[model samples]
Target chain A: MEDVLKIGGKEIKSRFFVGTGKFPDKAVVRDVLEASAAEVVTVAVRRVDPDSSDENILDHIPERCVLMTNTSGARDAAEAVRIARLAKAAGCGDWIKIEVINDNKYLLPDNKETIKAIEILAEEGFTVLPYMNPDLVDARRMVDAGAAAVMPLGSPIGSNRGFRTEEIVRIMVDEIKVPVIVDAGIGAPSEAARCMEIGADAVLVNTALSAAADPVKMAEAFSKAVEAGRSAYLAGIPERIEEASASSPLTGFLR
Target chain B: MTLKINGKEEILEKEMTLTGLIKDKGLNGRNIVIECNLEIVPRQTWGKVDVKDGDSIEIISFTGGG
Candidate 1:
């Protein structure tokens, strides 16, 4: 069965969401994007000179992919709102990934500020996806505030620590009404697959792919792993047991 | 007259429209947003709005990030 991932009234063919940061070069970005077959990609906005005819990052992204702009530098809701408005005004799209981080040490997201940004952006018809700590109450609040999806971090951003918050993310995946996308600190394909196996709607990977020896090949690996895990989940794996249970009968062979 | 653009001071020969400044900087003004004096200048108003002496303008564009 071919299952489609839908976000904000649009049908997405791929469950993998890739970030276009930390790549060796723009060429690698295009190659990895094409290889991953991801329909959603994240971008950040920053100051630019108008007179300089520099190659814009917008030009690197293909038209088929949805550009999900993020408010990465915003420390509070007001700043996030401002960035979101600017992103929309720039003709990027209505998709905004609300990332509000006040913690400088760990770069942990401020859940309250994220929810605040979501409430405002959602009122303006923007599809809001808030990056949040794996908190049940905040996840519920984000849903109530019209978040299109809840992105709970597995660990700190770019830490390469896999599934450090697995239990909490599992709770979010189980309880949230919207899609639970496991983002950040996912270092390997197996970790991403594990997330899918636990019923996560998707996983956002950046560091693991970009930091690999060959980003394009790693992107392909991740895509396949995501598909494999999703299929396994759909097919329903058997539950684990403490004691040994023989797959073959104990007395039936040659007796 | 002088204006601070993207944190750099530049002498303005005459009053320049926001659109003119954008074009003078070699940007086509698409896929970018401009803010003048802490307020977002809509694309439509870029032509009508004029940059005054000591005006601070910030121009921003999308970049690859997570």
Candidate 2:
């Protein structure tokens, strides 16, 4: 709302960066994305498919959008670094989404590995957008470690839950200079919009739309919701006061 | 088969279907990117993709925080 967030000199208009997975198909993905009007789309690199290269989804998305490569499978800093390099070798090194999960059940990020990865990757000259915790200490550590921006998740990744850490997100927004893009657990468009309204530089949505019945239409809804929230935040909504203000001065008259 | 998912191995009862393999490895529905034998599984057919014996499956899931 203040001036949509910019990450690593990339002008990100929509706070919602959609993941290109979980859709029924790429054509459906494209249609849903067109509806969402998201400027950035997230793509992860895994094996290239032992069987075929005939129909590659990454080859299909709109060309103008930013395609971010995530270190999704890396277990430790070393593994993440390897994936980052692989992403570079694969020609998507300019933007890297650093995700180093150690815990299996909840799939929480190993802070130590993540910081290590950020430090290592930043030294390698890659623009790192580390997905991290809302803890201000860790967020600062990540930024200090050379992360171009802090992608703090509102909740666990793919939880499709609302901002569980609203207080921490607020703290990060108040403290960090680089863009604070709210990533993960945004269940609906309003959730994305709410984060933007709360001063988050951007928001990332994947599971919510990808698993939806009609992704493209849902994407459009998310796009408009994000915009509406941004616009509302810019406009400055009216204050809430359930109780009426006392017009008669009780104490002042004594003066 | 010499395949390991998250550093553990189990014999496959049948050919690998993207859905079953991901589920078998305990990554049923996650924010993971899969690579089999060095090839990436397309987003769409993760449900239908198949993996063979001795094939390598690498899956990366997202974590919370920057």
Candidate 3:
């Protein structure tokens, strides 16, 4: 049987998802996507600058990948809905990541507003994936509101603080019916592996790769780590104990 | 005619359709979504829809983000 992740009736082969941001150059985005083998890539919708004729991000993304346009600039549910509609009207797919952040100091997503947006967008037939703080109540509400996936922040966006919400995320993986994708604040491949080990269905990485010294190489590394972590989860990690247990039996020691 | 584009006021020398405005501004052939007064104007209807004075038009596109 092939190990594939199914989201919104789409069978995704790779558990790794990437974001097109903070890249040293726009040209490198293509290379990074190829290296990471991410089937779902994230992007933000913004007003076109009348002054500069910059290259469109869509041109760099391959046709095979699903474009998950995020409502990053929206400060509330109404704003998020508008952005999603604009993204869909732009001829991008219906996949959307609801990121409604009103608090700029920490850039934390408001669960109430996120839920509101999810309810509205899902009703409109968009595959809604909400990025949120790791709270079980909110996660459950999101699912009820028709979220395709629950993306709990590992830390803060672009902070690269790593898996700070590990315990709650693990609980969400166990309880939530939809896929649990760890997004944001993952600085290293090890953190991605850890998220998988805790039974997350997938992860979305951006700064970890884009801000890396070698983004392409880092993308490859994250890809491997996600795979390795997923495999370990399937393999069933041993239970932890306070008392030490010797790998070699005492009676079997060479005398 | 005066129009608000992307939150900035601009003066159009003559009345034009949404498609005409797009072409005049050199925004043609790019993947863009346009909203007139907070309502989305479908791309197919751009040619038929005429731009009126003081219309708030928002032209948006995809950008890199996480």
Candidate 4:
């Protein structure tokens, strides 16, 4: 296996993280995770049916997989912190994806509130992975605030636009001390591969997988793409030159 | 007894233990977290803790999300 993604003293063999949202059948989530060989899966916290004994999201996930609970509906730092605590108490582990979004129009996360949440959650012994808007300064701030990983959006959440902030994300990949996992706006497997080629530590995907015609096959494709991109990044592509240099010299070739 | 569960008023026959309230609500309390009067009641303590009248309780569970 290649270099695994290490977080909170645990090593994840697969760098591709899958989310458990937007699926037609919730039972298929387990199959997608297995197909993608993903070790970490993200889930949201909400009220369960007090009267219903229907299978919860936890029942579908395999025991081997790590559960990462996200603060999806939180509008501020305090809410995010509370969600994290609840998730931990629910035996969902200490991994919390802090997402503080106030503006529902674009669903863009507030970096300031995210940093605050990361600080509080990290202090509580939670592995805080904050979702930001692909800003370099904010990425640094998140890391300083004790974030386990910095997740920056590629575009908007669930937009499938694919790397709208490529340059900004690249800057984060280059500068941030912790892992820079691209969180949203990835439409295709090619886009995921591109992020890996640019040296992203990992990628979290939901909309594309859930919206695919065959989510299982798409998950496999994404797994391959992520691996290929990581390999290519390790191989190091040669820099491009403006002038075309002839491989065979004219003087050396027989006239 | 009236208990606020997830901000909704639920009238019970009488004041019951937290575990009893959870059972009455059909939750096993295994995969859910409970907060009583702004204090987190651990899963182990649910059986011992009693739900008094006018208590504010919040129960949260893991759902599908990204």
DockQ of each: 0.81, 0.06, 0.88, 0.82
Ordered from best to worst DockQ, the candidate numbers read: 3, 4, 1, 2
Q: Judge candidate 4 against the unseen true structure and give its global Cα lDDT, from 0 to 1.
A: 0.89
User: Where does model 1 exceed 4 Å of error?
Assistant: A49-54
DockQ winner = 3
Q: What tens-digit string does per-residue lDDT give for candidate 2 at B31-62? A: 45666666656657787777666666776433
Scanning candidate 2 chain A in windows of ten residues, the lowest lDDT window is A47-56
Report residue A75 deviation for candidate 3 (angstroms): 0.6
User: Candidate 4: deviation at residue A29, Å?
Assistant: 0.7
- Model 3 over residues A40-151: C-alpha lDDT tens digits? 9999988888678677888889889999999998999999999999999998889999999989888999999999999999999999999999999999999999999999
Query: Which one wins on TM-score?
Result: 3
Off by over 4 Å in 3: none
> lDDT of all predictions, in order shown?
0.90, 0.75, 0.94, 0.89
lDDT of 1 by residue, B1-66 (tens): 988888999898977798888778777777889988888888888899999998898898988898
- Candidate 1 per-residue lDDT, tens place, A1-255, comes to 569888899988899999998876766888898999998999999899555555677777788999999999999999999999999999888999999998998999999999889999999999999999999999999999999999999899999898788898888887999999998989999999999998889999999988999999999999999988888888887899999998786885884
- Model 1, first chain, TM-score of 0.96
* 3 versus 4: better TM-score goes to: 3
Tens digits of lDDT, candidate 4, A1-255:
559888889998899999999888889998998899988899998876766655688888888898999999999999999888888988878999999999988899999999999999898899989999999998888988999999999889999999788899899899998999999989899999999999999999999999999999999999999999899988897788999988876586565
TM-score of 3: 0.98
- Record all residue pairs in model 1 with backbone atoms less than 3 Å apart, i.e. clashing: A50-B25, A50-B27, A51-B25, A51-B26
For model 2, give the interface RMSD.
9.1
Clashing pairs in 3: none
